[model samples]
Target chain A: MSAQDLDGGSDAETDGSGEMPKPHTIRLELVDEPGQLLAALKPISDNGGNLLSIFHERGSLTPRGHIPVEVDLECPPDRFERIVEALREAGVNVIRAGAEHFGEEVMVILVGDIVDSDLSDTLHRIESSADATLQDLSLSAREGTDEASSARLRLAVRSGRVDETLSVVRDLAAEKGLHVVEPLAEGSQ
Target chain B: MSLRLAVLGAGAVGGSVLDLAGDYGHDVVAFADSSSSAVDPAGLDPSAVHDRKERDGVVGEAAPEAVFDADYDVLVEATPTTLGDAEPGFSHVERALADDRHVVLANKGPVAERYADLRALEAESEGTVQFEAAVGGAIPVLSTISDLGAPHVTAARGVLNGTANFILSRMAAEGLDYEHVLAEAQDLGVAEADPTFDVDGIDAALKFVILANVLSDGETEYALDDAEVEGIRNVPGTALDLAAEDGRTVRLIGEATADGVRVAPRLIPQGSALSVTGTQNIVQLETKHAGQLNISGRGAGGPETATAVLSDVSRLE
Candidate 1:
């Protein structure tokens, strides 16, 4: 449970812990700043996690004008929770967590004046309220703010949690006067 | 007629080089990889090559020293691109060239990231590094440009990354999201385990650097940060829908003009070479005399990229 227990073992080999560390993929939203990625990585290292790789989408933009970062790391089960907590404490917006956690992915389209509807807030709400992670998103505004625009969202949710996510999405759409086009069910094929 | 060659880093591209060289009756001096245990001095047994075939024999042990001691005419660099580390794969190339061995490179990291330094080294040693396989796999973009009188390329752009294009194509065609399409690409092995290079525009940027170097009349270096890069990761499905509505398609384009060079995902009109469907790569070069020249073909994969290396070797001879 202590920090020393985590880094004591060699990177290639495991420490005295009986359990092997599991690999977890964490997606984060980071503001564009010098050493932002390194800043985000400090928590992972502090909690005894070994980095596998970093997928920093530099050109990518989130609602908060931040970059999307995807990190894969390996840590013991006990330290995994601490890593997450440390990341949160460090003010990192942990967008998604764990590899097996994102079991089902769904794509939904929303057609409306997305820009006028406070799109950023809407996306933040959907992610939090639906218990879903926004894996990817695309938006098209042909005529600018006054005209109709559509945004496509790729959401990853816990298995069997699609209904709740969809419900929240529907509620958000209704509130913002947007039309939601959901994909076909998994069993439809 | 036997060309003795040693390839450093037997990854997807390197393995293909070995296969093609072996097919053409070339004497493969040795296969050196990151793991030393995997070094095969008599050239890898054809079947042993087949066993580690998935990664193109890149995963096994690498023998960094074998490259220096091996008696080979050519060294092919197939290692990954490491930023700030000038000696990614071509460090082996440097050693081989220092030993007066020619180098054929499929790895762009060294060339794009360290063009000046490597070029200086190549000049000092008076050795040649032919990289016909660097820019466009089997497209002959580099050879064509060089042979076609080094046309005054005013502007250049293309759908560089096959994996990104494949993902975009699926997204446009099936209305699938990025994750679904990317997963499909990964399952098909068209993408790297760490797809950052492909998705984040580094791969395309590397190609642009090569193009700039080959096309430029003067010696100039393009900084990685200078290029305008936009990956398809943030490209929403709605953009594709819009493009579909507008009779256009989205393609990640790396373009250079007289004024500046830019690389980003842009929506181009459908039926254009850049918007060509599938995993094919299409490059449109605007030269002073030739006007607009379009070259299209398979960008990457074992067979296609291997053929590119063979073309370089043939040119060297």
Candidate 2:
């Protein structure tokens, strides 16, 4: 049978030696488009990856207006890294790279004039500037105005990057005149 | 297979089930609602069952007898959970079981308040009563526990009600008090009109009763009244204060132990599984083999609960 048939069939796809392709799971933030998922999958299959399962959370929209997708695929050990690089090179926003990427999690609360300073920009800075993944976020607008609003951010960063991540958050807060309540450590007021 | 099914109630849960069952090729024979009656041989036009009065109007002709006399392979009970009163719906379940018809229960009241009577009726008729939707809206907790042999389930706990949890999470996150958050939840259709069942801990209480019965081998003698019940009515902004003070948060936890079941609001440490469980969801179960297992997902709303009921129906042989 062809590789596509084996991958698409009910039974597990096995290599020439009858060994199963090693599975890797990657989380991607894709702009909701007609063929975004198909484009993402092409890199995996073209680079010799077998599809296992995909969880495309369409109803769930990220803060960046993109859908979060968790794709599980099987590939040879050598092709795994190439597939990841290909996905990134294709302009797919890789929220997370490998299973080890979600190892370290930290939650911090940003209190102050969140709305006035543009909360979205602050979050964007935290993610891109700090090299961290925004795992989840909870925002509360008590007065429903820029003067008084707060947000709780749950971030997943690489291990040992916590301090640097906190520094970036502190810098962003300083720039926006916001207060950071770092859960792992005390922050400057 | 053109299986004939009778929808006992046309509320959010029942109506959605009818819609899906019809969509999936199941013959929804008739809709028997407490409020109204609307039955056509071609099947119920779901739009007609939107209102309770409209449902009552359509089903009035068939009334009480139609439910008992209808030829159906399965009877779905989706009425609202009533405290202590097992009437009509309970009677409906009894009749369906007596007729050897498979019964699916999305209503916790009948299972919580009248589990024993219903179980006995099922035993007498040698029929099955599936209630996966009663405990956890879509978590598969009941089915999982049953599959795991319903081991010595010592304690069951976690965020039970999504509306209450959402309000509490919002209150803790944004420093908003109970009233404001509750109003938001109501506006979002997360909280009920009366809000008593949700905010007063009764909703969690009904779920606890169902879990207790399922884990206790259908023993309905457990005193739900004895179980302590507390709500977020008096949260006092403690979660916000705690978060501000130590970066911690609070969640309304419903916990039941071998000693007794307790439903109250508890402050969970930040990053704890409980705290991480955000809006409109639930998680936490402690059993024998698994020690402590956690399952979190949507715990309310018509669509989610309806999906759960459909999943249970799909498992039928």
Candidate 3:
């Protein structure tokens, strides 16, 4: 694999106030050696990027015997390019960068005759209508005395688009005579 | 400041208020059922009036209209909730305000359906109106909003209905289906025999509508139809199971903001402030400077709701 870019981010301007740091996912090719992952991340921290998460593809190697490391970091729009360049200057194999959108996970439950209503078509319509990717789905049918069934959909929605995506789900659910259980996502006390 | 009270409507709330009024240092001078009234210039014995209501099916020899003529300081309206014009309750408030006497309410109809009219009636009278029991019974939701000066409170939401909360919490906890749990709730008296008003989300919506009306502070007025309501009847056990698998629970949550009011079954984190169990009710007030305040307690019961009614009566001058 020549390290294709994982979904590209919107890279919206933050008015140069420099207060908001957009999240970005970066994939790097690292040799299977001790201290190699650390060596790849030093450039990110040095370039003022706050590391959100680091996923090391342990035991999974490319044909070149190099491990693929995924890093989720946040930095101002102006600093992302310099961070990628700095990583390349430090001899780190930068596979992909410049995804500036923050990723948010939203889960909603749809209840009704999910199978009879064409579940595949519903999922397709949701993904096709909203700017979201249906990451996972679980369904329960023909249980208990009631004929009603439920399906829980895990959707990966980009930040600031959550409300829009939820409305899309709600509209679809209404069209199919299904019920949608949304989350009160405001942080609770 | 002890108050002379004329209690109306002989339901559990009115009975509890009559039973507990003396304990709160207020005298029940006049009491009325739907068809009868007991009036005395000095005071009336709570147990004697209750016994008369229980045995003879009438509080006293006086007619129901006789309560209006009593020289009571406040009229406590505890009538059954009626929609649209919210009659009887609305008229009761109007009559009290017209008499230039304070009015305290345990009925949600007048406030939820005719909020602006209630305020307008209060504005014209020397006396004012207070209804703490109408929202979250015994939880003091409206009092908290007024204490925080409604303007400071940005929004209000919570599990306002006891029957719906009971059914949802029971289903989630026991993994039983909706019908099964609702049957159990009805058997346990947690839900009413019909269960339509409570389970269909109308009850909770009324409370949130009241919250929106109060939080708006005369900027706008809200009624029941303004809310977007979804009930817990459609939520199956499997949905709660899926939520529990993710460490979250499904609650019949209602929200009221300046934007609008919505009541639906929402997924909330388990054991959070809003995830109250059984018939417990919670009210979460979002403030401008202060953070979210969680007031959770017995949302409904005779004495519980009566306690709220008594507090409202005490607060009145």
Candidate 4:
């Protein structure tokens, strides 16, 4: 399809009377199977969503072993929810429906050998495993003792999935012999 | 109504029970340490008995087993909590029930490890078992559950250990590491010489386990092994720093529900009701009708736990 044809394919959007198309970010978890990425993208374009970027993290598998895909698209404000619904109906795992509905925010602390355990790898695994976004992290590895290292992670997890995200963090911590101090007040604010 | 009492053990709790029983309109007919016993058909003088114990290290002239011979109305079991079979303490409660006498307990072992067995014993005997002091000392956790109706109470969560709470709060307030704050807590007499039990989460876990047994209503019996316990020993000062930055703090919180029991060092909002500081403790009961009931106070010490034991004696009336 030509760029001009793609731009003018829908005349309803060409009219200036309707609401302007706004950019929305939807995070997805796609299986590593062939054509899975294409299958996930079809619903977006089919629903009149203008695709702007497809950030497919091919090698970084979530703890569940699924590839993380980030899609940035522009659509009318009302069509965003419907696009996500179509993705779900067509068997695509949507981690974040949009940037506005960011779900629950949880803070967890890891005590013991954090840097030695490969923090980036641990972060990647947890984000993929729990489908979370690491908003911020504070690490304290005292200059002396090898055992006194710790890092506190701030993550924004999908709605109602705080427990599931915690379970994944625990799994990774267990493997690395790192102690996890989980948040008790998950949805309590 | 005044009741005759037989106090067991020579620990702080038992001594407090002996010293304060009269004020609560109760008479101590028998008092026993692990190896010795003091018995009188009439009420015993607590001051004289305590003086003898302080000077001679023995409370009485009789054998410890002779406490059963006293004509007492309630057996106040204030022995140290032991795991596994919860022996001696369990045997004492069993013998008291077998004799058709009510038992008030401060020891956690019998209730946490052998809830079903204790309930079964209470069923077969003429007396019922009440163990208010075995959980949050002076907090009336079990009595509150009984008042709320066990079926109506959905869950119980709290910071059940004083020593652990003291260390965590001190670390947060001072930005001190775990070892540093723990040493200070030990010097302050907040934590015991062998801090393993309290800091390792066993003490908290046991309390929640007992809560589970009581809240489950005999459908499921829980012991220390059934709990998923994690201690505060591994909590570094940096961890607390991170929490403080987020307007939160770390606490060793234990939760008991119909599902089960768990105790761990968890992050909680600093100003939340469950975020009790120093040696203070709190129990949050999630009730079906009342929402969340937050009960906070001194969770341990002879005087504090004595109130709970005496309250149990009053309940038997």
Each candidate's DockQ score against the native complex? 0.03, 0.02, 0.39, 0.34
Worst 10 residues of 2 chain A by lDDT: A9-18
List of chain B TM-scores, one per candidate: 0.91, 0.90, 0.98, 0.98
lDDT of 2 by residue, A20-52 (tens): 444467899999879998998888888898888
Best by the lDDT measure: 4
Residue B106 CA displacement from its true place in model 2, Å: 1.0
What 10-residue stretch in candidate 1 chain B is worst by lDDT?
A: B53-62
Predicted candidate 4 versus true structure: per-residue lDDT over A5-40, tens digit per residue: 423344332222356665567899998899999999
What's the distance in Å from true for residue B299, model 3?
Answer: 0.8
Where does model 4 exceed 4 Å of error? A1-101, A145-147, A186-189
Q: Of models 1 and 3, which has the larger lDDT? A: 3
Local error of candidate 4 at residue A87 (angstroms)? 20
Model 3 residue pairs with clashes:
none
lDDT of 3 by residue, A152-187 (tens): 887766556789999999999999899999988884
**Candidate 4, CAPRI quality class derived from DockQ:** acceptable
lDDT of 1 by residue, A2-43 (tens): 212333433322222445555567889998889889999999
lDDT of 4: 0.87
User: Of the pair 2 and 4, which is ahead by DockQ?
Assistant: 4
